[model samples]
Target: MGFVCNGRYVLEPAAADEAEKYVNLLHDCMEETYSAIADPGFMVRRRAARDESIEEFMEEVNGPGVRCFLAYEVPRWTSQGGLSCAVGADIEWDAPVGLALSSLGPHEWESEMPVVPVVAGTRDLSQLYTRATTHGTGLGEALLRAVLADDEPAYLWYIGGNERAKRFYEKFGFQDEGIFGECGGIWGVPHGEPGQPLQTARMFRGGVVLQ
Candidate 1:
């Protein structure tokens, strides 16, 4: 069972049929959040590519290893309605979002050290973007906290140059692991001008272990 946040939304695990819908909403979050750093052409191309890859996206969300958590705006009286956001992850295999998705297994570093399962699509699931918004309501943090409210070690890929993301992850004790990657470059699809690559990095910390 889960509790209400923001006086209306319920945070809980997503249903089977709902996985695809969540992935679709991922586009909105990515576009809105990364819009400042990306050009219009890139956004358009990305959206189109995502739409065409719905099957692949759905497979990612519904993969056996993946578990999805979602936020929805249910009537405070009854529990049913608009799907607000979602976050999903797989701790077993390679995830469609470019994560190796494993814990206690081989890391990309060519070593056998155990790694933490990656939290997938959390940034998208933690954000609420309605047309009637005037400013951030801090509700995203609530959604994010719902999925990550744990002591077990988990990791995520934080994009470079995002101070807000850096600060948030820091609050959870996720520190830079000194591992760096490119936006699409990790998958060999580098964006930006030849010399200007979009870089991201790894951050790890023992679970926040909130008292």
Candidate 2:
């Protein structure tokens, strides 16, 4: 059976009826982690509509090329209550070569750039509500290992300035691949400013051998 990690909590996957709980958990995690750094007002507005968003997430999760996992604590008989932790990953698809090429327009070229395909992954480890309680256990590492086991030669991006997260990724053998220049400009998201693109790092693990 698959397990989800939230500090000391480990939860098994249940039915969609528990969607609200998972959604709330995700909102909390996002709020604790990214909200302070980014726009908390925007996050609050989005979190207010999390129920509807979760429905969409469920649809996409059940769809092709997507996988979701949830973790919870197994309580002892005398324990107060149990909490949950959730994480997920999405498989990458080939965008049209034109689209990919267009996305990379006007970027400096490195002579020996490695084309490691990107896969999306997320975790809610920012919430310290339950983290302090669980210590020295390998639950977090175990969850990461599970995700890595499923996808070999996979890469993911982490926003810069999150030094703690950067170290976590490094422990898993991911290296810093530098910032993405055209991401904000091309997407029109306006993260910081026109020229100050979001600092990002790409980390890869495992190897794929071709016959």
Candidate 3:
């Protein structure tokens, strides 16, 4: 079951109808985080590309072994007709404020760095984003915990120069393994200026054993 965090946000698995909304929320968060680093025109093109690939994205997220979680801000309670309304009665959830997406699969790096044998069981965190306004409300951690609550062998990548993201993952004991490359080379999309490419670095946490 999904849970509430900070008494103001509810975290739960994304529903089937949320695919498009998830994409919109994802880009909103990306714009907030990477607008300074990404070329303005590139961002526009990427948005178009994402729109065209919505179906693909949905398929991947809903694919077997994948887990996607969404977090919504809790609305305030109201009284009606001199009666307090039930918390879950007709409550409308605004667009999601946060998302965490992960999948269990063989470890694979999308860069030219020599490929390594795939681990039998690896949970790769594909995406995580929270609107800037939701920062510090405990929404991000709640989303993260939904996907990865243990110190398992897992991996993820973060855009270069995102110190806030770096610190957050570090708090979870994920270490940078010195792997670095252009974002486009790894993701097959021009997420930054060709003149000054957006770089990404991988972080990994390897501990604890699967039962």
Candidate 4:
């Protein structure tokens, strides 16, 4: 499935060959996100992990039961000499801007999740991210909608300090379960600062019947 959003981006199933582009986008987005809450040196420490994400990304993209979607920027056209240009005609996709990865099942980190009553048959939203430059252009929302079905029971984890992400999920009817857990390493960066373990909370939404 493919769709355009806000005349600025297009969403489509990610190609297996685009692992490098996907890793780069994820690195930039995560840096922008964690820089606000993490120590200044955190990104420096995360460099090796960021560089190594290509392998993991490739594995996941080609892994079983995983659906990965990518968003590409749309080319902008302008009229010449004050004439109207056929803006939407012959639209060309520019560059990759965002990505979302979802999976059914027992994810790699499921065992690490805080012990709680787990929801049965829930889809795991493993990742949803967009370049910081594309924020507010509805790129993130479009990518999210493309990955998960409406009224499908699903869950995702958010970093503790990322209020923006928490609020975004809330808009889609996901609620925080109040189960907090600490991750020593996230995306290959260790939360080594004393008393500052990487904080996380799970957010869930019920399917149609439960809703």
TM-score for each candidate, following the candidate numbering? 0.60, 0.56, 0.82, 0.81
Candidate achieving higher TM-score, 1 or 3: 3
Q: What is the C-alpha lDDT of each candidate?
A: 0.45, 0.41, 0.70, 0.71
Off by over 4 Å in 4: 77-94, 117-121, 186-195, 208-211
Tell me the spans in candidate 2 whose CA falls farther than 4 Å from its real position. Answer: 2-8, 14-17, 77-136, 181-199, 208-211
Q: What is the C-alpha RMSD of each candidate to the true structure, in Å?
A: 9.6, 11.3, 4.6, 4.2
Give one digit per residue, the lDDT tens place, for model 1 in 24-83.
555665665566655445555666676555665455455444445555443322223223
Model 3 TM-score, all chains together:
0.82
Q: Which pairs clash in the backbone of model 2?
A: 4-70, 4-71, 5-71, 9-72, 9-73, 10-72, 10-73, 11-72
The candidate that achieves the highest lDDT relative to the unseen native structure? 4
What would the per-residue lDDT of candidate 3 be over residues 1-211, giving only the tens digit for each residue?
3545535666778765677888888888988988887655656766876765567567777777788988776566332311233345343465788889988654344534433433556787888999999797677777887888677678777888888999998988888766677765323444444646667777788752322
| Candidate 2 per-residue lDDT over residues 1-211, each given as its tens digit | 4433432344333235556655665566545555434533545555767768679555544543343445554434112322222223221211100000001111233112344333223221211211323434555465455434443454455555666666766777666667443333221234553233334555544552211
Worst 10 residues of 3 by lDDT: 77-86
Model 4 agreement with the true structure over 124-208: per-residue lDDT tens digits: 7889998888888777888787888876788888888899999999999898887787665543334465335567788888751
Clashes of each: 0, 8, 0, 0
Q: What TM-score quantifies how close candidate 4 is to the native fold?
A: 0.81
Relative to the true structure, candidate 1 has a C-alpha RMSD (angstroms) of 9.6
